[model samples]
Target chain A: MYKVKVYVTLRESVLDPQGKAVQQSLSSLGYQGVEDVRIGKYMELQFDDSVTDVEGTVKEVCEKLLSNPVIEDYRYEIEESAKQ
Target chain B: MKFAVIVFPGSNCDVDMYHAVKDELGEQVDLVWHDADNLDQYDGILLPGGFSYGDYLRSGAIAHMSKVMAAVKKAAEAGKPVLGVCNGFQILLESGLLPGAMLRNKNLKFLCRTVELSVVNNETMFTSLYEKGEKINIPIAHGEGNYYCDEETLAKLQANNQIAFTYASDVNGSLSDIAGITNEKGNVLGMMPHPERAVDNLLGSADGLKLFQSIVKHWRDSHVVKA
Candidate 1:
C-alpha cells in the first residue's frame, strides 16, 4: 500500500487573503514576530498494492484535481507499507 | 434561439437563468443536468452560479469534472455562446475554457450586492446591445471572485480585447479590476457578477437585460441568410 501526502498552496505571486487575516489576528494577539502566514491545503490518499507507478499517479492527480495550476502549486510525498 | 442552463449538483441559479431566457428574453430554454452527455441541440449555453459540489476542493473545481463538461467544451469549440456566472465562471476557469482563476475575495468575505460595471468591450456577441463604456449595475454574490492571472496572459487579454467588463470601483481584488472576460475566440464569457439576478427592474436594476438581448440579436443576425 502507498500513502501519499499532498500540499497545495497559492502561488507566491497571488495574494492570500485568508492567510493575511490570520496573520492580522496573530499580530493583534501580541505575536509581533509573525511576519507572514500563507495558508494551504494538506491531503492524504491511500493506494492499493495493485497500483503501479505510484509517483506518476500522484503527480497526475495533484495536477489534474488537487491543485489548480493557474493560482496554486502542489507537491506530494509517498510512503509504502508492506501488507500485514 | 434555444438555450441550455446547466445545473450542477449544488447550482442555485439555474432557475434564475431559465427565467431570464424564457420570460425576459422570450427564448426557448431548458435546464440541463450536469450528468447529461449532450449539449449539441442548444444554440447557447449558460452555467449558473451557486456552491457547486459544496465548493469542495475549491470553488467549481469538482464540478468542472462533470460528465457534461465535455459537451460544454464541444459546444464552445463549435462557436456556440457560453456564459458562466460566479461559480459558473469558476468552473469555466477550472475547465480551462476561460483564462485565469478566482481567488478569495480580498476581504475574505462572501459579498452580496449590486455594483457598477463598465462595459469594457461591447463588440462581442454577448455585449453587442450595450454601448461601449456604458456603466451597468449587476448583482455580485460570491466568496471567491478575485480573479488572477499571470502577466503574459493579462497582456494577451488586453491585446485581444478579451476583457468584457471591469468593475467601476475595486469591488474585488481581481487583477486589473476585471469583473468579466471572454475567450480569445469571443464566444465564451466568464464573469463574477450575476446578470441573471438583475434582469428585471423590480430586482433593483434591469441593466443586465440588455446582455441577453445582445446575445439574441447577434444570433439572429448571423443565422439570417442574406441573398
Candidate 2:
C-alpha cells in the first residue's frame, strides 16, 4: 500500500485574493517578516495493494481533476504504507 | 426550441432556469439530472447557478465531471448553444469549453445585486436580439465571479469577439470588467450574472428574456432550413 500526500496551490502568475486578505490581517496582528501568503488545498490518498505505480496514478489524477492546469499547480509525495 | 437544464446535486437555481424557459419564454424545457447522459433531442442546453458540490474545492470544480457533461460537450462541438450561469459558468471554465478561470471576488465578499451590463457582442446566437452596445440590468449573486485569463487568451478572445457582456461598472474586479463570454465558435456562453432570474418585470427587469428568445429564434431559423 502507498500513502500519497498531494498539495495544490495557485500558480505564481495568478493572484490569491483570500490569501492576501489573510496576510493583511496577520500583518496587522504584528506578525513580522511575513513576505507573502498563498492559499491552497491538500489531500491525502491511500492506494491499495492493487495499485502498482502510485506516482503514475497520483500524477494522472492531479492533472485530470485535482489541479486545474490553467491556474493551479500541484505536487505529491508517495510513501509505502505498512498497514495493508 | 427544446432546452435542457443540467441539474447537479447541489444546484439551487435549477427551478429558476426551468421557470425562465417554460413560464417566461414559453418554451419546452427539461431539468436533466447530472447522471443522465442522453441530451441529443435538446436544441439548447442551460447550466444554472447555485453552489454545486457546495463549491468545495473550487466553484464548479466537482460538478464539471458529471456524466451529463459529456453530452454537453458533444452538443457544444455540434454547434448547439449552451448557456451557463454563475456556478454553471465555473463548471464550463473547468471543463475547458470556455477559456479563463474564476477567482474569489477581490473584496472576498458574496455580492448579490442587480448590475448593469453593456452588450459587447450581439452577433452571437445568445445576444442577437440585443442591440450592440445596449446596456441591460441583470442580477448577479456569487462569491467567485472574478474572472481571470492569461494575456494571450485575452487577446484571442478579443480578436474573435468572444466577449458577450461587460459590466458598466467594475462590480467584481473581473479583468476588463468582463461579465460574460462565449466560445470561439460562439455556441457556448458562460456568464456570472443570472439572466434566468431577470426574465420578468416582477423580478425587476425583463432584459434577460430577450436572450432566451434570441437563442430560440436563431435555432429555429437554422433548423427550419434543414427541413
Q: Which candidate is the best by TM-score?
A: 1
Q: In each prediction, how many residue pairs overlap at the backbone (N, C-alpha, C within less than 3 A)?
A: 0, 0
The 0-to-1 C-alpha lDDT of every candidate, in the order given, reads 0.95, 0.94
Which candidate wins on DockQ?
1
lDDT of 1: 0.95
What would the C-alpha RMSD of candidate 1 be, to one decimal place? 1.0
- Candidate 2: the clashing residue pairs are none
Provide per-model DockQ scores. Answer: 0.94, 0.76
Span of ten consecutive residues with least summed lDDT in model 2 chain A: A27-36
In candidate 1, what are the lDDT values of residues B155-221, reduced to their tens digit?
9999999999999999989999999999999999999999999888999999999999999998999
lDDT of 1 by residue, A1-84 (tens): 988999999999988989999999999999999999999999999899888899999989899999999999998889887766
lDDT per residue as tens, model 2, B43-96: 999999999899988788889888999999999999999999999999999999
**lDDT minimum window of 10 residues, candidate 1 chain B:** B218-227
